[model samples]
Target: MELKDRLLTIAKEIPPGSYPVDVGTDHGYLPAYLVKQGIVSRALASDIGEGPLLAAKQHIEALSLSDRIELCLCDGLTGIDLSDKTHIVIAGMGGETISEILLRRHPLTQTLLLQPMTKVETLRRFLLKHGYRIEKEIPAYEEKKAYTVMLARYDGIVREGDDFFWTFGALPQSKKKEKYLYFQSLLSRLEKKQKGLQKAQTQERTELDRLAILIAKAKEYLQEELYDHHSGNL
Candidate 1:
């Protein structure tokens, strides 16, 4: 089972020998890939809906990974037991949903690989507030759309900040081309929003000012990264 770039990016973040439980395992390709490649001895794949779970079952069976990858029908992690798993992948979902799943009474001690389709800022904030630390972020491009795969671990440390770090990301990303382009794309979006709300109310104006500052700061960071790359300082 070949995975797309986005899914592959998420899969690569899962450590070897990890017992990964893929939340919302749409097609189960990730777990199948991991098992087939001998990256992990076993995994648990779960989906909220019957349709996706059925498809995942078929895909896992076709790859003959049924024994290595267990399938479960559950909402988030409600009906599944992750006591033995060390890694949890919550990808291809909205940031809000991912945050909610991590909050579902399960101990957030597992390493997490998250790929939020939207609202990455919200997801980052949630992680910071909930005592998780993002260890690394890798950017990938699929069909001209950019996606970021985040690897986080539960550290029980509540990160505090409301700056560009929260909006963009922690500094020193993997230094890939797509990573640079991802921040550029974020700058473009912030600029557009700032312009569109130029004549907004006082509260909106404050938000706009913050976006402006973030845009400038992101530009500076990218320039420094580029310079370091050229000078072999990265």
Candidate 2:
């Protein structure tokens, strides 16, 4: 089975000649792809539940990749063991969940590929508060959903001071129409909710304010050259 563009990007980040572990691998697709492409010599496919574990096993068997890929039934790195040669991928989860997993499994590995389904800011903040350095972030929209997958490494001290770092990673500010229009559309939607809604409440107000700030900052980044897309470089 072919992987999505976002998943492929995460897979490609595993370096040219290295082994990687796919955490929360739903169907063992990524490890299989990497092994077949000769990008990685081996992979450990892990999932939290048995349903996905069965699916992964079936896929691996179909592809005859049992030797190249190992399947494990684990919960958020509960029993994960990573050597110095392991690159980890954790997706299909919230940012907080990803952060928790890493917090428990820190000393085992430093290289991490993270994709959070929601609460990404919380994840980014948690990483900074801890000792993780977000090296790279790639944004992609697939299946009508926008996903930001990040590559992070271990550090001893926390990095700080960027307020909008979670929303826009080092992707060059593009006033080139699509990005500006998307931000505008998002702003419009948020405004519509805040304007004449019959069920206006405190939670909605709080969320509306947050979205508004994100929209304004996005505009600022687009209007200026202050876009910070990566963690390592500027």
Candidate 3:
């Protein structure tokens, strides 16, 4: 089966030297691709549901890669003694759900390759709060949807006030033209809901304001910081 453009980008972001644990691996294509590309030594394909695990098993079996890829039926790595050499991948899931999985693991993980389908800001905030650094962010446009593939390491806790930037990358560098337009589109959608938001409780308005801050700060970064060009490395 052909990998979708977004998932292919995610597969590409895995470091070249380490085996990865594909959490919630629906079809096992990522592990299949990684091993085939020599990007990883082996793979542990896992999913919480039995249905997906069965499919994963079929994939490995068909590839005749049973020796190289191990399939596990796990609910977010629960009760699994994951090896220290394993990098966990949790993509194609919601940010909030991904956060819970990492929280369940606590402070032990080799690396995290995460791509949240929705609530991306929530996912980034969770990673930063739990002490993960954005190692690399690869951007891709697939099926006319732009997505970000993030490589994260358990570095240290970072409480950034920049509003969920860890999902995209640090604000300073993420202000690339394409991302800027995406942010603007998000803000435009929110503004169109101004009437509904304005009628909401004070707390909801506050939440909307916080979300808007991302676009506001981004504009500042593009108009001002990009031109500075000297205070820090580009």
- Candidate 3 deviant stretches above 4 angstroms: 164-185, 195-234
RMSD (CA, angstroms), candidate 2: 5.5
TM-score on alpha carbons, each prediction:
0.91, 0.80, 0.78
How do the residues 1-234 of candidate 2 rate in per-residue lDDT, one tens digit apiece? 577867886876788777788889998889999988878878888998899999999988998889988888998777766764568888878888888888886654458888888787788888777777777676655675566777888876778837567555434243233344434444465457656442554556666676677667766765554334563222
Q: In terms of TM-score, which candidate is stronger, 1 or 3?
A: 1
Q: What is the C-alpha RMSD of each candidate to the true structure, in Å?
A: 2.4, 5.5, 4.6
lDDT of 2 at 158: 79
Give the least accurate 10-residue stretch of model 1, judged by summed lDDT. 225-234
Q: Residue 60 of candidate 1: its Cα lDDT?
A: 86
The lowest-lDDT stretch of 10 consecutive residues in candidate 2 is 170-179
Q: List, residue by residue over 33-132, the lDDT tens digit for candidate 1.
A: 9999999999999999999999999998998888889999999988777689898899899999999998885458888889999989899999888888
User: Taking the tens digit of each residue's C-alpha lDDT, what string does model 3 give over 66-90?
Assistant: 8998888878978767765557888
